[model samples]
Each structure stands twice: as structure tokens, then as C-alpha cells.
Target: MSSYEENYLARRPEYLCHMCGKCCRVVTTSIPYKELKKRSQKGEKGASDFLSLFEPYESIEVARKVDAAVVDNIINRLIDDGNYNEEEITFYCCKYLGDDNLCSRYHTRLTLCRHCPSSPWSIVPPGCGFEGWLFWQREQEKQKVRLLKEELIELELLKHRTSDSQMLDKIDSVQSKIRKNINLYKRYGSENW
Candidate 1:
């Protein structure tokens, strides 16, 4: 195993998620039913149908009350990475979450639902799969970043042998691009990337 993998493995914790369904109802992405249908037709089942059942909070603060830390973490990460604009940062919720706190469409839930709270290092909601999934994702991201950095180093060394300044400049530009991509992935949960 790579050092990164080893480090993550060493830090992995054991926790059983108690499916309180609090996270599901407290905050959701507000996708319109029409758009969801379109996505479903295109085989994007998760995105397409989610907005059909639940209503989004008129304001984000309401959603944050359910789990301020998780909501804040998601919002900050999106803002830092520039993937979400201010309007998109508004609080959202799933349509299918019933009053009983069970997903009405639990059997047909999206991939995200199946792997929710999937982080290893972070503390998760009660009955969340946070530790296992989060650990795996962090390790994967570290591996990807390590590979990109290695490639950048190799390109840098190549520049010393080539008198072509333009070629070197291009390599540098590519390296920067790669680094930015890595940073983007890091800022968001690995699933988003």
C-alpha cells in the first residue's frame, strides 16, 4: 500500500450508522420534477426524480437547523471550489422523505443515498456510513494528487534538458491545470467530482 493508503487505514475507525433519516429530511437538493424526469429518461435516475416528492425550505437557515455543521461544510466547500453560486447554495430537501422519516422511495433511491455519510475521518450523523466511505474517498483523492504531483515533477525535470522555453512553458501550464483539477476534487466530496 502507498503511504497515503497506509495512513488512512491506520486512522480508520469502527462505527455503526443508526439510520435515523434525520440527514435525509433535514437537508435535500431541490431538483424540479420536470428536470428530474428528463434526467430519468436520460438514465440519470437519481437527479431526475428526487425533486418530485419533497419540498425545499424557503430559506437555507431552516435546513441548517437540522445539522448546521454538515450544511455549513457542504456550502463552504462548494463556495471555495466555485462549483456553487450563492443562489445554488440555498437549502434544499428531498421530496420523498415521509413524515415517518423513511424515504418513500427507499428501494429506488439514488446512488448517493446508498452511500450517504460515507466518510471515514469525519464524524457522521447517527447511523451514517461516514467512517468507511470517507476514509476510502480520502485515500483515493490522496493517491490521485500524488500521481499528478509526480507527473508535474517529471515534466519539470524534462524542462532542464530542453532549451525550448515555449515547450517548458506549455508543460508548466498543463501542470497548473492538473493541480487545479486535483484541488477541485479535494474541495468537494469525492462523489461530486
Candidate 2:
């Protein structure tokens, strides 16, 4: 087997995705119309057009029939953190997901599809492909944060020796933003953000 296939086999103990595509049929992410227009202009019409194909849910409970536990968990977390609104809790899915579990716009599918529930660290359906990817992504992110922290320490030492207060403040602010973003990713998992 190719190294990639071999690696996947070695790491993934159970690959039970039947590709029934129920998850795809039932769940979706919504983007604002302005953002959709921008993406369409950039040749991402599938995502832009997706906004027109689905209706929004009124509540997390309504969204739950599709995947209530996952949806509730995400919504509750975001709400607790003050990052989400009640109106934004609406769930959606494309109208083009046919009875045969195929997307009419499969070729031009959005980033949501590429990193759907099956993607790493997501609360995908049971037996999805997220478990292995989540572990790998966490390890990679930890390594990245460690490296960035080291760089920030070095920059701090340099800042202490220099009298450029403005430059020092800028560097400190930037580093703080990076650390905050890293922490956000760590806390929420890459998929949720």
C-alpha cells in the first residue's frame, strides 16, 4: 500500500463510514449574503449558491432531529461564551442532496463539505472519520503553539534591550492575539471555529 494509505490504516482502528450521506443531507453551515457574494465573485459559487438552497431552523431542538446532541453542545458552548445569538442558532442543509445521497453540486462543494462532521475534531455522526484526525490535529497545534511561544520569548528579550516602546507594544499586542487565537482553537477544536 502507499505510505499514506498505510499510515491511515495504522492509525485508524475502525473505518466504518458507509457513505450513506445522511449527515450531509441533514446538516449545513450558513454564511451571510455579503460573504456569499464575495465567495461567488472569487469562483466559489457553490458556497454562495448554497445560501439559497436551505432554510434556517428556529431552535436548537428543531436542529437536533438532524443531529441534536452535537448541535446543542456547540450552541450551548457558544452561548455560554457569549459568542453566539439565539437567532444565529438556525440549522440548514442543501436542497440538492438527493434521495440517493449525492449532491448536485458535489464538484464545487464548499469548505463545509471538505471539513464536514467527518473532519477532525468535529462532533460528527458516530463512526465518522473525525476521531483520528482530531488527535493528529491537536498534536500538531500543540507543537505550533510551543514554537510560537518560544519565538515570543525571544522577541520579548529583544524588546527589553531596545528603547522603541512603540515597536515593543506592537509586538506584544500581536503576540497576545496569536496566543489568544491558539487558545481558542485548542479549546473549541479546529472544526468548530
**Residue 14 CA error for candidate 1 (Å)?**
12
Top-scoring candidate (lDDT): 1
The weakest ten consecutive residues by lDDT in model 1 span 118-127
Write down the RMSD of all candidates, one decimal each: 7.5, 7.4
Error of 2 at 144 (Å): 0.5
- As a whole number from 0 to 100, the lDDT of residue 122 in candidate 2 is 51
User: Which lDDT tens digits does candidate 2 get at residues 64-138?
Assistant: 886765576666656675667655445666676777777777787765564354333454544455545666765
Model 2, poorest ten-residue lDDT window?
Answer: 114-123
Off by over 4 Å in 2: 1-23, 28-47, 100-105, 108-112, 115-127, 158-193
Which lDDT value does model 1 have at 156? 81
Question: In candidate 1, what are the lDDT values of residues 69-146, reduced to their tens digit?
Answer: 767776665566566565554555677777777788889877566545433434344445554567576678667877
- Per-residue lDDT value at 188 in model 1: 46
Query: After best superposition, candidate 1 residue 44: deviation in angstroms?
Result: 8.0
